[model samples]
Target: MRRRKLSPEERDLWSRVAATTQAIHPVRPAPPDDLPAPQSTPKQKPPPPKPDLRDFRIGQSAPGFVLRQDLAPPLSERLAAGPVRMDRKAHQKMTRGRLEPEGRIDLHGMTLAQAHPELIRFILNAQSAGKRLVLVITGKGKRGLDEGPIPQRQGALRHQVPHWLHLPPLAAAVLQVTPAHQKHGGSGAYYVYMRRNR
Candidate 1:
């Protein structure tokens, strides 16, 4: 391919750039090659001097990296503003139990220690089985508690189950964790979104 020569305007612009680059930083003399080597008890080199603010003139080429804004696409073309790619409406549908769950696990009557491992197993299996939305029944906690210094939380599993879903072992397989619809288990249950096994 034949290379195109710069227009007169471009030549003038580059000439100005070259002139300013040289003017801002006068050339420094190099140390002589025959200079004696430093002693074993080496003196610490002084820190580099601060930049001369005047040398930071606009349009001066920087030492390392520069983002080429001129080459970038227009804002409208780059952004393509619209609804986010994530289908939030569909996610809402799943959370509302409008979509049928692929699997269900009832964790009622189980202690927290027992329920934690069971929850992990259920999610892992569901993901491997290619299940997306699964219902976990945690049972709505008791309302009234005996008055004490520290009142116990109502629902153990309901609160703790969500935390377990975010843990490393289960976080990979799970996506969104939302309360189940009235039909599934309502506040007592949750709809666990699982990632597809690849």
Candidate 2:
């Protein structure tokens, strides 16, 4: 259907009527009393104050202490009378050949490439020779490949010895392991105790 456009006078009159309606109906706000009151939150309790003490003594000596006298040999004498039993198996393993001068072998300056095959042969030969204790110096891999490309993640043999000991030929011969003495190579070496091949 065709619609006819409003003339200029009619358009002007419609716009004035719309403006009058908007001015009269400007949004009426809610009364102030209808809005929420400010909340009154309770105050939190403060932490308790630190205690004050005039006299507090730790490790205080007791007055008039009577000592019980020993009727047997002194503690040191008693301990020395019997062989000292090591509580740790590892300590015992490390000292298995403490009295034997020829029981240990140091492999400190050798690399994994050199030591791996030699270690297998060494264990078999030592076992065959009836040697129970052997010292291996894998050195603490702390100084591993510092200046080379593809730097070693482990301290050379420091970390590799234990894993190598667990391999087929070596694992079959080894009975126990423990950290070596400072004179023997300290943390860089280990005392590998082997079981006698029957």
lDDT of each: 0.75, 0.65
lDDT of 1: 0.75
Stretches of model 1 off by over 4 angstroms after superposition: 1-86, 143-148
Clashing residue pair totals per candidate (backbone < 3 A): 0, 1
lDDT per residue for candidate 1 within 76-112, as digits (tens), equals: 2332232323358877687556899988999988999
Candidate 2 clashes: the total is 1
lDDT assessment of candidate 2: 0.65
Error of 1 at 67 (Å): 61
Error of 2 at 158 (Å): 1.4
The ten-residue window of minimal lDDT in model 1 covers: 75-84
Residue 166 displacement (Å), model 2: 1.6
